[model samples]
Target: MSGQPTKFLVPLLLPISWLFAGLVAIRRALYQHGFYKQETLPVPVIVVGNVMVGGVGKTPITMALVNHLKAQGLRVGVLSRGYGRKTSSTLAVSPSSQSQNVGDEPLLIARSCQVPVFVGNSRVDAGRALLSLYPDVQVLVCDDGLQHWPLARDLELCVFDERGVGNGHLLPAGPLREAWPRKALRHATSGQEVPCLVLRTAGIAGPHEFAVQRHLADFAVQANGAKRSLSSWWDTPVQALAGIAKPEKFFAMLREQGLNVTHSQALPDHADLQNLHIDTAQGDVLCTEKDAVKLWAHHPQAWAVPLQTTLPTELLAAIDFHLAAAQHAKLSSPHGHQTA
Candidate 1:
């Protein structure tokens, strides 16, 4: 949904946004010095992040970038902070890794991207291990890390899902992780207040941006990677479950694709559906591709829709320029440092 200076709430939230901005500024300054510790990765790191909260389709973009690098014949590895994981140590994400262990996003990445994927509280540590294990790996892509300055980054790609800096606030009051204007003012690179790379689903990033709509596939992929047409389920009213951000979007997409959805189940961001059993025996059950990574372990018959995002040619061009620049900078400097 697009944000606007509504008739009611926008003015009221201004003070709180200012305070949040102040807090962000303070935390960043601490990191700049030694007050807060930040880590440096041994290899070049590419971070894809967002200023606004929620799914701006980061996973798809990450997967796209990873594949693009792989197509270019460059060895690539993925690193994430493992936001909702159970373990605290830096470890590689296993195909058998549970969402509770390696976190949902990383698990999804590992599944689609065959290259090594790791998650830890430290992206730097993850990147280091990934590099050590696969020395040929030239690029490290970090998921959801713009504020995480601890691990330095060579290239930063910012994603916005139609929510371009919501309310332009920091934290609680709005969706932004930091103040928008302050970022433009300060030439902060790693995290402070920065303009990494603005992404519209299918548009150029440098000037203004445009949205690229994400549409669900007409079918769901099975546990064995088999496909089932959504139209096949259109005759019966069934359960449509989603555990990712914006579950309603999933439901809407299902309806748009002609699924006769009746029960729409929305769970927490990384919900463990292994425990919940639905009466799907009565009808067809559906879920999102990200959720299927976890859900299909229990219900192999679960149908999950894959979402594909189209990035504009212009942004792809911009990315190529930045990647080249980063590689050049790295090759040019004998001693280098970067964060995720």
Candidate 2:
């Protein structure tokens, strides 16, 4: 529990890591034995998650996928554990969905895509309720449930930002929530087979993977939806703040857009703005649209840069193939009734 690192810690860590890995093995075995049942929904579930913890660009990718699905005429709904939510039950995400309830990411998805979203500790239950509410939804995107074992997925898209599995170690030592090697193997199990997409939203290139980019809106918008030109803030040194996994990126992008930011604050992902006391008189406040969900209540003058993200065409092609295959599977199955 101390901040100091000892030279002996490395040797001790291997044995300790081995012991932890053994526990993970045992947990996997218990699930395999039916002691823990991995639940599957009637709809196809695409899990957009990362093996590495934090800042892997999952939210942008999730929103991009949801937009693509909706564009392809697929009725898509989203399920998320709603990581920082106050409630444990399944709650529908509407304009009214609070970051305190539905979680920040789900609220982001709901806001950007205008699609049905539900959040709960159990992704399976959230998926069930979402489907029951919107039965026509053909696909379900679990926002960050790659390791959430209860709900099964047909596609497991492991998103990484520029940082690819930092230090290649597990939590406490490195950034991963689980061991990296288990990713491929776990995707092969659960009766509901899964496929992997090594996706990067920006600076990506080539085949099985694709490159994409994120953009901020030309005009920053207030919580009331009033648009303010980026040029308006050119006169003052602004504070670019963020509470997302990739806050650095938001700050970087702001600088790239030629803004003179006086300071930058990187809060934990989905930070409640109620706790932030900005020096409004010192300078203007700037933030990402994700933070806008809560910042509105606390700081009216805070300007949020709405992100415009694009998924690579090649990645979209693969997803299209899966969606088509899923449709065919549905029509050919005994219990399946409809096709789209």
Candidate 3:
């Protein structure tokens, strides 16, 4: 989702984007008018998603959230749509789960967070299944479901990288999935502004948004639990690969660390790498943690560089406040966990 088209191209694609925006408006209206039902889970849900269609470092943020909540003694479970998985059935993720079964991101989160995770086509269903299986789970964190109206969320965190609302137009014309301020404004008009907190994953923070610091860990971990400094591979031939929305960013980071990435491959986001081949002779294969989850199954020699993130204390406090407030409201209601 990088290298977006020039602004001049916006005119040519505006009609289509307008159509898409209209459809989005209509769909949201349906949910608002009660024509379509929204389901609320038994536990509080915090959604980490983006306004534009691209990776904005949501998984790492989710992993950070998992760590923060666990420190508070909250049993948090994750739910995802399992985008690009082969199966459509809802299922719980495990350490042994393959990317083809539960998608790479979910599998990575499950392994990294060591918490229950469920994935399916429907986020609501996945959340329910996770709660049923892990009854003690106090909260649910949805990896990417801000626009998933069917699954009501108590809190939403919108993530943005350096490209904040890129060009600020709708899909095809620009990078946005819907009009940025307009859509959010519409929600405010409906008397519920979606209780969202804006986060900048990269670059300068926008107004009223918090900045999150992210950096690659100094060491990369092997599938067998072995670890080595990134500098150890500096002199070796290395094949760098990333299947994320912005693969170049990962490559650039590796280069910044003085690792010579002789060969770099950028596959589609969430791509199944069963057909791709990386020659070790090119050097050691270095990849993002999300890619490593899938790549390790086929290529055990590949090393995963995890992203270390620091979230602002104010943001964490806000999230905790919202979760507590939602829980308080839930306790006051006679009927447990009704739709919003």
Model 2, runs deviating above 4 Å: 1-8, 32-35, 183-193, 201-208, 337-340
Candidate with the larger TM-score of 1 and 3: 3
Q: Estimate TM-scores for all models.
A: 0.86, 0.89, 0.93
Q: Candidate 3 — worst ten consecutive residues by lDDT sum?
A: 182-191
Query: Mind giving the per-residue lDDT tens digits that candidate 2 earns over 1-340?
Result: 1122244664556566567667776776666556887775666778888776666678878888898988887888988888888888889999777788778878878887999999988888888888787888888888887777666677788876665555665555556667775634342233544678877665544365556677887789887788888877766688889998768878888888778888888898777877888887657888987898888777888888988878867788998897677666655666563524
Q: How big is the positional error of residue 135 in model 2, measured in Å on the Cα after superposition?
A: 1.1
- Residue 79's lDDT within candidate 1 is 89
TM-score for candidate 1, please give it. Answer: 0.86
For residues 117-187, what per-residue lDDT tens digits would candidate 3 score against the true structure? 99988998898788777888888999998888888777889998888888878888888876787455222
For model 1, the stretches where C-alpha displacement exceeds 4 angstroms are 1-17, 30-39, 182-195, 201-207, 335-340
What would you estimate as the lDDT of candidate 1? 0.74
lDDT per model vs. reference = 0.74, 0.76, 0.86
Give the local distance difference test score of model 3.
0.86
**Candidate scoring better on lDDT of 1 and 3:** 3
Clashing pairs in 1: 38-150, 39-150, 151-339, 151-340, 152-338, 152-339, 153-339, 201-212
Rank by TM-score (best first): 3, 2, 1
Q: Which run of 10 residues does model 1 get worst, by summed lDDT?
A: 185-194
